[model samples]
Target: MTPLLRNIVANYTSQLYVILIGLAVVPQYIKYMGIEAYGVIGFFAMLQSWMSLLDLGLSPTLGREASKLKAGVTRAGVLKLFLRFLETLFSFTALVVVALSWILGPWIASSWLKLESLSPSDVALCVVLVACIISLRLLSGIYRGGLLGMERQVVANVIAVIAATLKSLAVLPLLIWVTHSILAFFLFQLVGAIVEIVLMRIAFVKALPSVATEKFQWNLLREPLRFGVGLAFLSGVWIVISQSDKLILSHILSMQNFGEFMLATSVAWGAYSLISPLQQAVLPRLVVFFEQNQHDKFVLLYRQTTMLMAAILAGVAGTMAAYPEHVLFAWTGNLTVAARAADILRWYVSGSGFMALAGMAYVLQHARGDVRMHIRGNLLNVFILIPSTIALTLKFGAIGAAITWAVTNLFFLIFWTRIVHKKFLPEIANSWLTRDISPALLVGALLCVAAHQLNWPVSSRLLSFAGLAVLVVATTGFLLFIQAETRRIMSFFLRGIVKILCTKNV
Candidate 1:
């Protein structure tokens, strides 16, 4: 397989594995900790996103810096640059984590998070534990971006698979055998975070050996810092866009209801997972292409990747929209939770699909180092999204939060995309819609409508899961392979697979 496609597949494999592990663990976690405790865990999930605001765009900037090496920087030069970058990032992230944990942790545990079963002390301890986990993660995140810049995704994903397994699957035993507390759960994650950092260090050394021997210098960071400021704000804006609804819903709904919402959010994110790997795989290459002033190649890669990504995302989103209740019940084994979240999941997942498309546009802008469009778009969301979320939640409750999320994304899909295309690549403005989006939407909507109308009996959970799985495959395959361009790419991909198998056989 081509290196880009290979990286995408490997990354997707790792992500899918993590999703499955989390799916398996959720029921056990809810059973052990109960929904309120699990909701606290969900709140921690939101806190992780909040904590990422401290990243200051350092990690992605690191990736962008490393990708510049493709322009022919020496190993020593690259290592010097990287070490300087990491030093600044690690030091700043560490201090922020300490400050945030010390100041905000107590407030969040005591006042912010709405708790029911867990005591204030217990909740406080969990907050502190999550702080530590996020701190370690913040420290280690640069290597992940570094690996992406190096195009070392296969090795990166191997390390990620190991880390994902330890953080997720290992938690079940920790909860069952060790302690049935959220504090204990997060403590285990802290340990996993440390180990992940260590493995990332090893992977970095292996992937870029000279980096291990180089001395650090602060000078290399000056350029990246200037670039990173915009990126950092962009990251924060997105985190706000993503987490604002959940934050509002947390206040409006009870802890148990919020937990149900969180569950559905998790599933929506899993669908979005289909887009992320492809985005990461394309980004370094896009940067290199832009740097080389190859606009045609850049546009081609952008369009092709968007088509493939949108098609895949459409299928995943369609399935969730079509079978939210069945899928949730099958995954969580709580019909009440499933029932509560089913409607929200449909709206949220549909929005996620649109968000995935917008993500591609955002990535293109980032690759070009043109953050103006994205910044403006996010600013618009801040003004519109936050107020709308608050009003909707106050008036209509949790479902309103979901609707607001969907509407905000749909708005971005039309508005931000037009601005991005107009500013960057006006030529494909009409073609992108005609070729990539409209057809996929038509197919996805039809699949959702048809699948929902089917009289599939939910007599057995396994049967329901199997039926939904078929629908997912059918939807994804129909959209993904329907277009002539995508079909051609698939044939090439298949040929690559065949070539690999033949070589192995020899």
Candidate 2:
């Protein structure tokens, strides 16, 4: 297989493994740790998202630069110098992250979070550990971006699979056999973070082309600094748009309720997770295409990947949104939790699907080395979303916040995406909406409605899950079959299989 296709497959495999393992283990975490403790874990996750703001857009910049290096637009020595500069910058930032975490942990545990069963002291310690783990992982992103930029995705994904397995699965034994304490969970994560960084650093250094006398150059920062600053602003706004609801709800809802909300959000986030592998694998190639002035090829790749992503996301999101109670119960095996989270899950999954589709615009912009449109769009999103989220969460609790989430993303998908296409690639904008995105979404939505109407007899959790899985698969297959390119590929594969069968009979 070609490197790009291979990278895409590897990334999808690695990401799917992480998602499946995480899905499998989360209910067990709630069962063993209790919902209140799980709330703390959720808090840690939010903090991680917030901490990404500290990256200052350097990680993505590194990835882009690495891609440039591979395309012969950038020299290996300069790439090495750039990596050194980021590494050094991150070292100081890591110290600051640890210090801030220590300073804020006490306040958050005492005042910010409404804790019930867990001790404030233990929670504070876990918060500190969370900081350490995030800082290490933040450092690791420098290397991870470099590897991805170089298109060494197989190596990167293998490391990711190993790290994800340890982080998600290994923690189970530790929590069950060693201790159920939240502190123990964070400690295990801290160790995994350390190991991940070490592996990433070694791999990145090996991937770097051999260059003698690599020296840090201060002037080299000027070019990426402009791009990185725009991205940093974009990142900050994105965090606010995405996390403000969760942040507001954490304070407004009870700890147990917040945990349930988080449970729903996690499942909803699978929509984005499903699309992210394609994004990562596509970005470098997009950059290369743009650099080579292959505009037709670039648009073709963008439309094709966007279609595939939309199809899969529609299938997953429609099924989950349509039958959230069954989805939650099948996954968690808790009727009470399922009932509590079902409405929230439905709305959040819909929002996540739209957000993932809207994200394609950002990828297109990023590949072209301009994101001012994205920045402006997100700035507007932040101003509107933050106040609305607070008002909704306070007025209607989790369900209200969930509704706002869905509406905001849909608005961006419709309006902002159109604006982006008008400016960048106006030729295909209407066709993109009509042909690329609409078909899969309409079909998937109809299938969801039909399935719900059928009222399949899912008498048990296993049956509910199996039935949902089949529906999703069928919807995905139908969507794919409707697409001309995918249909042709599927036909070729089927004909090959038929020929093999006939030969065997003869």
Candidate 3:
């Protein structure tokens, strides 16, 4: 297989593995750790998202520079120097993160989280450990970006799988056999983060060409920093827009209720995971195509990948949104938990579906190195989303926040994508929506709705899960079959198989 295709497959494999493992283990985590403790784990996840704001866009900028290096638009030595500067900058920032976490941990445990069973002191310690783990993982992003930009995705994925296995699966044994202390969970994750960063650093250095006398230059920051600053602003706004509901709800709800909300959110996030692998695999190639002025190739890749993403994301999201109670019940085997989280999950997954589609436009802008429009769009979104989220969440609780989430992303997908296409890719804009995206979306949604109406007899959790799996497969197949490109490819393969059979008969 070609490198790009191989990279995409490898990325999908790694992501699927990680996601499946997490899915399999989460119910166990809630069972063993208790719902309140799981809330702390969810809090840890939110903290990591918040901490990414500290990156200030350097990681993605570095990834772009690495892509330039591979295209020979940048020299190896220059890329090495830039990498060192970012390393130093991130290191100092990590220190600040730790210090702030130390100060804020106690306050969050005491004031922010409405804890019932867990000790404040123990939760506070877990918060500190969360900071340490997040910091180390943040440092790993630098190397991870470099690897991806260089298109060494196989190596990057290998490291990711290893780290995920250790951090996720290994923790189960520790929790089961060693101790159920939440602090122990975070401690194990801290060790995994350390191992991950060390592996990433070594792999990144090895991937670089042998260059003598590489030295960091402070002046080199000027060009990339301009791009980084725009991205940083965009990233900050995005985090606030996306995480505001969670942050608000964290204080508003008790820890148990928050955990239930988080459960729904986590499942909803699987929609993004469906699209993320393709986005990552295509981004470096998109950058290379743009740099080389391959506009035709760039547009083709963008549309094709967008359609594929639509097929996968729509099927999963539509199924979950259409049958939220069925999905939650099948996965968690707790009808009460399923009932509690289902309404929230429905809207969240629907929102995530639109958000994932809108992300394609964002990737288009990112490849072209112009995020000014994206920044403005996000700024507007934040302004509207924050107040609305607060009002809705307070008035309606988790469901209110979820409705706002779905509506905001739907608005962004409808309007922002047009604005982006008008500027960067006007030629394909109409076709992109009418042909590339709309077909799969329509088919997937209709299939899901039909399946839900059928009301298949899913008497047990096992049968319910089987029913959902069949629905997903049928939806995906129909969506792909309706797409012209995928249909053409399928016809070619079928013709080849028929020819082989005729030759054997002759």
Candidate 4:
């Protein structure tokens, strides 16, 4: 199997386990927390994401550099060198997070508008929880960084699944024990982070034999900071683009509404969490293939990944779009929050699919050491996005913000595709240039639009519409993505199911 295919297998395996287990308990947690409480969870999660903003982007860069070194060198020596350097760099990043949190933690809860309904004590609790969670995450990144640096996505995925499973299983019970109690949630997070740290250390040792020694290399920091800090800034900017909305919205809108936006954003982002591990898995393979000059293999794997992601997102998007309000209620069970979430989810899906492809392109750029171009596009995006989001949201609310996000991302994708083609894939570049994927995207969007047009009963009788919505989504998505190869895969699966059914009958 190619690197992409291998990575996909690893990612899918871990994701399957995580999804089935993690998703099983998430809804219960949400129900227990209520939309507002859940929104608080979302806010802290964003802070965690933000704290990760400074990750050296050196994860993939390290993998690329190591992959090149691996071609002719001993892994043991190289791994130690790489780890020593990373340790030094992350020490600084962690210190920065600590100082920043100490300075800003108390203020975060005060300015956020959504917390008006929440007691000052509760908001204070959330902020403290977020600060601790952020600090824990910085430490966790060390192990994750090693996995990515070694192109050990399978290992990275294993760690993620374990962490997610632990997190999901813990959330509901704790919420039940202490309803919306931020201290309780903070303690749960502290415990979970410890579990993740131990698991990650174990996983890193077993999965990537690069560094098993418990050695410190503090002096190695200066070199990595010199070479890697620029990349870290680029990564931080990208995170800001993806996550700053909540902080910004908190400033512009009330924190309660921001809480609603936070919920919608969380649900919208969950779909990606399911998909990104796959992308992370595929990337190292792409880098290896490019290094090998096996362009055809790389392109084929890229194509396969794109089709599968699009198909899955289309099905997911269509289902939510069809009975958005219904699924919203069932998923979170808070109608007011659900309504807001449904709109964001529906608008966000198209962008998710669009970005998935562009994300691949960006990953490819990173693998090729072309971060400058990616940085260029991000710079353009911020200028276009911040003003638009601020202005549109002021006029049109969350839906308007979602639309701005989607449209700006489309432009960003176009810009990246142009550069990638001009620099790399001249032959297939035209497809991206002309927006050929637009047709497939249209099919998914149209299904969502059709469902909205139908305007079915969104009341207590929503299950009836839910069934119809699921059916419509499944049917449309299948027709859109059921290429010849996918059909063959389906046939094989169906045959197995049939054989089992017949054996049972006999």
lDDT of each: 0.81, 0.87, 0.87, 0.64
Model 1 vs. true fold: TM: 0.95
Error of 2 at 439 (Å): 0.6
Which digits, one per residue and each the tens of the lDDT, describe model 1 over residues 170-279?
Answer: 88887888788887888888888999988887786666655344455556556777778899999899898889878777776668877888999999888988778888
Query: Which candidate do you rate higher for TM-score, 3 or 4?
Result: 3
The residue-by-residue lDDT of candidate 3 on 65-110, one tens digit each, is: 9999888887888888888888888888888878888898899999
lDDT of 3 at 443: 71
Give per-residue CA lDDT, model 4, range 15-124, as digits (tens): 76776575456567556655455556666777677767656566544555445544443345555676566667667766676667656655776665456555666666
Better of 3 and 4 by lDDT: 3
- The per-prediction tally of clashing pairs is 0, 0, 0, 3
Better of 1 and 2 by lDDT: 2
lDDT of 4 at 310: 58
Sequence-dependent TM-score of model 3: 0.95
Cα lDDT tens digits for candidate 2, 254-306: 78888999999999997679898889999999999999899999998898888
**TM-scores of the models, in the order given:** 0.95, 0.96, 0.95, 0.84
Error of 1 at 182 (Å): 1.8
Q: Worst lDDT window (10 residues) for model 1? A: 209-218
